[model samples]
Target chain A: MAEPNRSKDRLALSALGLFAERGFVGTSIRDIAKATGLSISNIYHHFGNKEGLLLAILKTASERLLHELQEASNQPGTPIERFKRLVQTHLQLSRGLRKEAKIFFLDEEHLSPEGYRANLKYQREILDLYREHLLALQEAGEVNFKSPTIAAFNILGVVNWHLRWYRPEGQMSFEETSREVTEFILHGISRVREP
Target chain B: MAEPNRSKDRLALSALGLFAERGFVGTSIRDIAKATGLSISNIYHHFGNKEGLLLAILKTASERLLHELQEASNQPGTPIERFKRLVQTHLQLSRGLRKEAKIFFLDEEHLSPEGYRANLKYQREILDLYREHLLALQEAGEVNFKSPTIAAFNILGVVNWHLRWYRPEGQMSFEETSREVTEFILHGISRVREP
Candidate 1:
């Protein structure tokens, strides 16, 4: 990456860390500059203000997640398979973008009004990705439910919360944890004796 | 309630609103006192400090939730019914205590260490309530999943995230939304044709 791109990346990453640790309001521009070794002017030049840095983090995180979810949803397979792939992709992204994802979940209140509106658009798109596939699966007689949107919300809920407790050094690897969580969700825990 | 009790309730409620809106670090004791119209000494006399107020809010919220979960779990019914009731109680609580629940979900990072540990004990009891019921239901062949603890977490994720987007004036009432969300979890969106 070019120097500017690298500096921007460093600045964004530092902002994510500070926002996660100290909160968006609690964290200051000087804190970000100090963390990244970038002057306050350079930081402001790249992003207009603290809110701008936050917007940048939200945009980058959501865009990357949206792209991955789209790809996973487009994969050729059963509806259940597509759902599983979406969950797996979500788990991987949550791991890779740990700080950014945490900030996204906790810092939405800090987004300016216009940024929040735009961010909601991205959020709806990601949700629609889940809802559309769920609708298809329901129509095809694969998964059974009354509301596709609620189902999508439930599905997203299961994976979005992984950022809180999912650990890299935990006993269960991400793959195993994802598989177990996905299975538990789809089939539930009741033992159904083979008919 | 006694005069002191009423004043404490007002102070704690005001603290919850401020904590949810401005965050723990952002909202000061002066702000809390101003919001409650309580003098700083009165506030301090009731709760030693800001952390005391926070701990009180957390303790009250968790106790109420834990009590409800215990009641719902102990209700005489099948495993599925108990699970549904748990979901219903969770929905109602989430609605009734919106600010406190939001703070519970988002402001844990600001809790003092002792508060966090006590809060974790309450959380564990709530989770154990879900897990034990799921285990019973699994043994009864009512629901089928691999891990009880993971299954509980999945169920929780579905309801907990409602703090983010659940709207009171939206198309669905809390009753209707809770029913749909609960149904989606139990049956999923996959349409399974009856054999």
Candidate 2:
């Protein structure tokens, strides 16, 4: 027999793929059930509702990211090293979780307010941790920017836009893109005054 | 009475605002007529059909963007200066034609294939312009990236996503965000290699 949890995992993954393409309002439990070859009853057994399933997916990814961040923050050589590791880990995690990221971005708004707020709390915590790291780098004279918040948004916009259009089949490996971004960011913010 | 053509222009602008928020499918000719106080017949006379009005809006914005790009490119300056000018012009243009930009980003697929192709052709031309500009900058040592295609997308993503979340009423002006982005892009690519 198929592993009991394996069927549920496959069902959840299929649901995520549909959610990414059709959007939350445009999808239904019947759609998920049809895609996964499971009865609607089985889908309901796995998830209380579409909202509960979306909540489960989002919370799972958030925990993965948060655990990675907490680990990276604890084990690091330098501020720059830590920042670069954060970028690297983020890129790899994003690549592996590309489908989930799409749903996380476009469908999170569909979650009920209480569920939405709960997910956002974890997301904001992630941003805050990165902001603190960048602040430390700024304090150390390693980088320069006028406003850390705007700068943080710029950094994130540059990185996170990858989810919208990045293709794994592209000419470069995920490593190359990560390296390029980190190099550009570190070099871009180098603190030397004009000669 | 206001000049009838002046009224026609106002009618088109109001249609753009409603379409941006409600999406093309969610909006209807009746809604546009109600919003503009023009009978559906009057709007039909001016724009031919609901789809016709959408295309007219698309054409107006695309032509304006193309004209601005040509003007920016014609400016006599270094490639970097030309690029910086392009960024400024684009920011200004997006701010002025925000509703149109929103429609293009959010619902271009709703346009007829012929209309969508027309819209995309202009977009491709503008994207190629940016690609060419960056290639020339790489040659001139003003900018360098491992992947110019990805870098261009990253830069444009930062600029365009502003429409979704930027506060026109906030402390930052359109020009200020434009300048900040220009600085960020240049600095993100500064030539000095510092670890």
Candidate 3:
């Protein structure tokens, strides 16, 4: 049981790297098998097909995000504090799961209609978590913004877009970058008295 | 001359739609020609090859963005005003060139090394434009933030990200949505007096 689980992990990790570098259509099952030193049959047995592998990767990443966000939302804090925790947790998870996050954004279109819808559902749930927090902040008179839906998407854009440009070796460490992002977001949405 | 230019525009437009819908590797020269009613050799004649077609599309989009951003930067205003114009221009152009923008983000990895570097330069220029405005704002003590580089990226992320979720028939008109985004960004970066 342990051996099979390890092999499955290896296969998924290798496939994630290839898909990130090449793309869903460009990376074939043979490519995954070659990268992982596993048999094509084994790849099939594990993921069923290329799309299946993509779904598995996306599902794991999405579920992890949803879980973390749920925990963040449940924590006791002011609306501002909870929102800060939510942003920090999101940035940390996104950095930790960088490649998976990239595929979640870029390769999602390749999923079959059913797979696409399922992935989108996860996305919507993740988004709703953000929206819920923003709504709370609005009710608390802590944040000012139009359209919770648009505000939620804007916050996500700021956090998720880092996947394209953030590098660990760059000047700012992950912790520093996370703090900067949180500051920008907090100030961006906080209520301002008329000048 | 006019006939040839029209044909080229058609070819590029057809390829742009196909590339956005299908991954670049998944899209063939034959597919573009079929969609455009042009011969395969004709596509080659106009753009040299598929990579050439991709380069042309990216070049157009990048140049247009650069031109608009430059114009916005040069307009008469404070750093904050210039930044507002810049953001509005970006959202308008992105919404106008939705498919091309999508390809510019997603299919850029497929370019040759030279093409990739060329595209990166344009992107850097765009970033520099954003950075310059933020730096000016920082100098004037109008905005509070760390690392103009990350600030610029966050702004772009917020603006560019509307490509994914914004819909024409949705609740907000393009003008209304643009206003909401610009307002969010303005508040996000503005300096707050300590309580």
Q: In terms of DockQ, which candidate is strongest?
A: 3
lDDT of 3 at B51: 91
Interface RMSD of each: 5.3, 3.1, 1.5
- Model 1 regions lying over 4 Å from their true place: A188-195, B188-195
Better of 1 and 3 by TM-score: 3
Could you report the DockQ of all the candidates, in the order they appear?
Answer: 0.41, 0.35, 0.64
Give candidate 3's total backbone clashes: 1
RMSD of each: 3.2, 4.0, 1.6
Model 1, A58-83: lDDT tens digits are: 89888988998788768899777877
**Full-model lDDT for every candidate:** 0.76, 0.73, 0.84
From the highest lDDT down, the ranking of the candidates is 3, 1, 2
Model 3: lDDT of residue B83:
81
Best by lDDT: 3
Instruction: Choose 2 or 3, whichever is better by TM-score.
Output: 3
Error of 2 at A57 (Å): 2.7
